[model samples]
Target chain A: MQFHTLFSKAVPLLWYGSHVDKCEKLTRAPGGTRLCEASSIVVYKSSLLQILRLVACEVWDHLLHFVTLLTHRIIPCLDVKAGRVVKGVNFLGLRDAGDPVEIARQYDEAGADELVFLDITASHEKRDIVYDMVRKVAEQCFMPFTVGGGIRTIDDVTALVQAGAEKVSINTAAVVTPEIVRQTAQRFGRCATVVNIDPKRVPRDGFEERRAEREKQGLFAPHAVIPDGQPDDIVFEIHVHGGRTPTGIDAIAWAQYIVELGAGEIVLTSMDADGVKTGYDLVITGGVSSAIDVPVVASGGCGSPEHIRQVLTETDADAALAASIFHYGEYSIQETKQYLHEHGVPVRLTH
Target chain B: MIGIIDYGMGNLRSVQKAFESLGSQATILTTPDMIDAQVSHLVLPGVGAFGDGMTHLRDRGWIDPINDFYKSGKPMLGICLGMQLLMDSSEEDAPSRDQPIPGLGMVKGTVMLFAGDAYGPGKLKVPHMGWNSLNIQQDVSLFADAPENPHVYFVHGYYCSPADSNVIIATTDYGSPFCSSLKQDNLWATQFHPEKSQRVGLKMLENFAAC
Candidate 1:
């Protein structure tokens, strides 16, 4: 019999953390309690079996509350140049969006789970301006927001936190000095430290050709192989300095490394899909999300609420960050969350 | 005036700013001398390891003053790690599995890390970072004017299990119904950050300020 026949007759008992794909893999089960040999899924629809499933799911629900109760966070990012919110396509061509504080207040009222402010034009003299902007946002906005960009030292992290940023994200600085992440975590705790990873997909063939030429020139060893089975015949390479410079580091491996160094959260953005607003790069997002223990915020290329739902449901990402959709007033935070909640993704809906 | 204790763990400004937003003058008590008679309400705000918190309090000579303030019968509140510090001991930073580190003993309880294998194969992540609903158990002024089952922001790995159940005002289920907040006489504590919890949290702060 087809699996759809079983589905039509009986409901698959989905407890907490049970994926739909995992449920669809079920082939057969002799009884409700017994697991099928092929897919190891137990399916049952009898009244007594349904009661048992309910009781079991309830028991597991309480047991798994620590993991299951964490609602997916919807973070609206503000890429600020000096003090005003700015938008850029693929990290260039800056256009003024709005006042950072006003946009932050709107998101706060709209019940956004969190907010992110990145100083796109991170400069030395602009540090004071960022600090002032952070302080203003902190005073007006009640929710947690992370400030990133040009966070080069521990003092910068301290300044931002003191200015009311619950967490400080390190992007280029984290890539330059990995010790900064460890130091920040050690000093202020892991929850206060966030590492942002902007990864762009590179053609595997061209990358391999460059590597071979460099290796023949004795610049480096040839053993730095791209891991097997990368999706779409491409490997994600880490980019720094507002996605202007590319580092030869593997994005997934770098994520694991940063996690090891005690980054509380990882904001993974796909430069290839950013600003286009089609959808998130689920392949790399899922890749890094699965490879690490810390919460990964899948960012970039979120055009619609369905995209948000897809990334949250498909990938194990704990949060989704979008700028264009929210900044442009295409959708309110409440509407997006309503869409997510309706689509079976658990989100905190503020009335 | 509200005094927020700063032992150099986490951001105390947000808490102060939260109180300030509610038309209350709040101060970050950096030194032990700052915790004095003029301070009406005391807030012990912390985020980090239990041992580190205890060490900071002891090293900074805040242990005695904080205890004295608690004994003063004035309203006191604790947030996140501050809630854990009210306990007698904690499993975190313990010398051994059996020998837990000593807390302030202001409240009778023990803090334990969420065990990884409590729920079979898929273990839960630590630092339970996000907003979760509070299953308010007992009536308290802190939750006065707040909505039923209001969600609050929490970001911690360990949970407080007070030996005295009477002190537990609200119990949240984030895997087995751990103590989320407690109110005993003049002292109140919560495992969540009221400062970052949006409106519901601000209301709780307002109620505490009123107290």
Candidate 2:
């Protein structure tokens, strides 16, 4: 039995070592590599006697895996319309999911790393309703939450933060003012500031054939263009006011600019992938994630756990934000996390 | 009742709500006088720059009253910037001043920025945001009956480095092993927000209430 235990423990060490290259992005933070090195050495020395028996591998792998698992965050987004959690496809065709507070509580119990509430139809008079809803949601759950939609000024950010939001995501306001992002970050620290980027792939010459190729490649369906190796004469143009208006700005370049302007994190959502669930826009997601030093959350186009695994492993995104999959009771957060773990995409599973 | 010191920074409501959920009444103390005879425990909850934090605390006339409360031998808890405020000084906003801003000096340590000279850049994220596992180094009252290596929510650019390693009850690795929680006499402090950490965090707050 002891030999069997040792063998089981020793085997995963080799597996972990072979997969170390995949974990390079996990150590993006400064001095992170040194910490990994120092800890492994300490673990080695502490179990020196077990080295010949190959028994310390489990301990080393466990510690290192815990560190790397922090890289990927699974966020469940609640698109709120008049206080109810609503679901929409391609940023339109809204359907009721459930009560905002109730859904938030459910997500909390399901081990969602964070929760996002976007007031889809936010207006001046109805601001109080959103505040009350945010406070209620905050009261029920104990995880970090972000509130976005119609967040125009520092006052909006402050109100949400005061109402129990850890981070306030700015979308339309960020495009209109641009300085609000910097101001919010300066006041509440960069970590509390998040910028949501909604971009649609601009149609170019021969767009139909290219989109068909993408559909064949299995990224998306119904004429969704996924960028290939070549530039392919496509630009991801930014959209605002809940995807109703186009902003003529490039998504990748806008992401880079906002990060420089003190946006600590970016939530990149593909307008085309809003409810498709085929997968995240890997090409653009990867582009924005690599272009910026800050963390990027790949939002939209998450149908199955496989889609999540693909985005996390294939792209540089630090997290995956989904709405429809979790909203419709298709799969619980635990199942998704379990799937990711089995597929070698590290995620924190809390019981 | 637990007294949460609100010196014009941080989300004190969440801390208060966490305690309320745990069947404890947490009152937000705006003024030093608000830390009256009814308050049994003191919670210093804050976020933002260390220099700004100190300035606000001093401006609100919280220094002397807080020190007095500490001397009263009651359980005092600090969260995030509130934890940093307990230290001797901080490197945040140091360049603008001739000398580093002084903390409460209840503990001997200095607050250092993650991207500052110590950890340098590109190794770790500036603000060690999100959930991380806590490496419990000592069996303390704050973490009594706690699960092994419980993950907690953390959001801060600066971390507290206590002069005495003995005070460190837990250490969480973010680029390197930085102090995540510390305990000294009646004072218990954590760099992570127990309020936002979900079940494990709620349990910690329950433990703190019990203490």
A198-260: candidate 2 lDDT, tens digit per residue: 988775544455445545766322322334343657767778887877665667767878888
Clashing pairs in 2: A29-B123, A29-B124, A30-B122, A30-B123, A30-B124, A31-B123
List each candidate's DockQ score. Answer: 0.47, 0.35
Give a tens-digit lDDT track for model 1, residues A236-330: 87788878786666688788888789898899999999989999988788878867767789999999999998898667688999988877678
Docking class of 2: acceptable
Tell me the tens digit of each residue's lDDT in model 2 across B1-211.
9999989886778888899999998898888999888999999998777888898999999999999999999999999889999999988878743477899999998888775224322324456767777889999888987777787888788889999999999998766688999999999999999989888999999998888
Clashes of 2: 6
> With candidate 2 superimposed using the best TM-score fit, by how many Å does residue A27's alpha carbon deviate from the native?
27
- Candidate 1 Cα errors over 4 Å, as ranges: A1-67, A88-97, A205-233, B120-123
Q: What is the TM-score of chain B in candidate 1?
A: 0.97
TM-score, per-candidate, Cα-based = 0.84, 0.81
What's the CA error at residue A163 for candidate 1, in Å?
2.1
